[model samples]
Target: MEGYETGAGTARQAVKMDMPADQPQTPIDEVIRTAYDNIGLERLETVRALVPRVGMGGLSPVLLNKIRPLFKHTHLVKDEYLFQQDDEVDFVYFPENSVISEFQMLADGRTIEVAVTGNESAVGISAVWSTSSAVNCAQVCVGGDAYRIEKDVLERELTYSRPLQRWLHDQINAYIKQISQKVICNTHHAVEERFCTWLLMLQDRSRKNKFNLTQEYIAGVLGVYRPSVTCMAKSLREKNAIDYVRGQIFITDRSKLRKMCCSCYSELPPRRVF
Candidate 1:
């Protein structure tokens, strides 16, 4: 616990590496190397911050301390399924720099992304109030670290904290808005516009301009064919808005990319919730 800081009003300790430092190495660095070398303290700080979507933004420090122990840090890989449709909701995931996509499965074996979650929001939050199975498949679209708390543990904690409960409800409302916008965008916008919007959203969540996304993956998320994604990528590259090589896509000109996006881009949530 040497590299960790105890919350101001609670005995709970959280990783403190997020603090800015002028020196390249300090006493905190030494402690991190000695005590938390294997955990990657920087990545583990996702749970330590008062992130809004994680439902810790406005809670009292004492309440945060009581529920902090319920969370377990996890590293999620791209394309890994956090929970499949119809599966029992076991845990809720709080992505740090990672990105998770909730896909609605169709009977024709197609999957379309309904919502994308990042540090601004959590995944599988519906489980907090319902004991039913998952409705959509939640998968890690970008590989990175996250924190997860068991559904039952979070449910129990919510029962004791009104602030946490209100936070969760707000997150749910935001999530619904996101899904609704996706529906409108998919129905009314062109594929090129939708593609640009999707890329921007991914960049917003992952905090990276370059993404290791294959055309196949993009097609699946957009509910389009591989050839269509290929065509759209080619157009974006020709316009100098983006560049793609093999499985990677790079946002080369953000301004140009934004220009290509439809109205949906502006309708989406801000980069940060709090």
Candidate 2:
């Protein structure tokens, strides 16, 4: 616990080197040392401020204190896969300003995103029900930091904290609702409308107006042809709703995007059973 901090105003501590000065370093150790040298304490504090954005905002102090010990703060890069389908559920991640997409692969090798969860939801909710494997592939669409906890520790804590259990259940229900709505949207909505809805949803989740996403990735998530996504993106750019260059996109006119989106954008309300 020498390099760990648990409090309201402090950032989690970095790893302290206790080995002898002449000790040989492993490849992994060298990488970690480099990372520690590069990431400043101020940046870690900035990340700590975003932790409260995870899940419901009213977590009891007792519950937070109990669970904080199990969390390991780490950064997630864009396009990184947290868990692949059928993989053993080892950890649950609480993202902060990170957009995670749950995608189900089809028989024809195509993938379709079932849900997009941000700070308000935690990935690997299957651990709550004691599931042994991942149901879908969870990938980070927007790069950011997150607190990850081992599934065993999380399960133990969930068993002891009723508030935590209830909160997680509600979050899981909200995620299920998102997947259900997306299913319907993919089936009935036009490609352009669905694209707008997806973009708006990503923006809301990441709380950022700009994104580094390729058209191929967008098409995969939307379950549409890449050419179709290219066309739609171009049209949106022409309408001044967004700006796209290479693989990056920026929302230039949010009002126009809102107008172009279907009612489904706002219809999927976040519900709580607690």
Candidate 3:
């Protein structure tokens, strides 16, 4: 083999590095171009519709433009993980006709939902204060599209926009308040009452009288056994509070449903409060 002698009297063989030609091409400017395309005039109309729902509609034209460039449209599918617990938070999402659920995993492999975010709110709002990770598992509870912005870009803009900062802070406070109240509700409320409360919350967020949700998923969200959830569903059905067929739940009797729920549902702040 052909070799070269070094000054140290060591011989080294010549080598040729082989690289794959089919590797994906990712140019620096490609991201910028894609973002521009995703936020085009047609999409800007969608953003205009969402900004108000997420409580960012009142931003000044200059600020809105600055922030708008940071956002890219996103589609969130059902049962998809936006981010897992303790995962790095690279982006914060603003739901537009979407619902995201936050879940806390227990030591015994069980999980319970701590909160839900919908069209009128933002997901991963805690990213603004945290370092770069999430505290809970975030998933798409309902399939829909949204807008997302990098944490760094949003943080940079937050430092310069007083209105945006204040609005986000208010939203964070509201979220914390919701989680705290759920703690008390789960501790003191009955399973049937809690079940009703959960349905009402889902109804409010989806803005629909009916949605597809199985009893097993409801059990997981409620942090109860499957049998318990089944019993509660049967009870609700018997009381004419709701009609559960297969995986779909229909709120046929809204008044009865509300009456069955604990006061926690009404006591919580409305979705648009922030």
Query: How many collisions per candidate?
Result: 0, 0, 0
> Where does candidate 3 clash, by residue pair?
none
State the weakest 10-residue window (summed lDDT) of model 3: 1-10
Evaluation by lDDT, superior candidate among 2 and 3 = 2
Tens-digit lDDT string for candidate 2 (12-67)? 23334333344345444343333332333334345446544434222456776777
Off by over 4 Å in 2: 1-62, 269-274
Please name the candidate that would achieve the greatest lDDT relative to the true structure: 1
| Candidate 2 Cα RMSD (Å) | 16.4
lDDT order, best first, reads 1, 2, 3
- List TM-scores for all candidates, in order: 0.76, 0.76, 0.74
Q: Report RMSD (Å) for each prediction in the order shown.
A: 13.4, 16.4, 21.8
- Residue-by-residue lDDT tens digits, candidate 1, 60-137: 557557777877889999999999999998888888778899999778987899989887778999767886899899
lDDT of 3: 0.68
lDDT of 1: 0.72
lDDT of 3 by residue, 58-78 (tens): 234565577787789998898
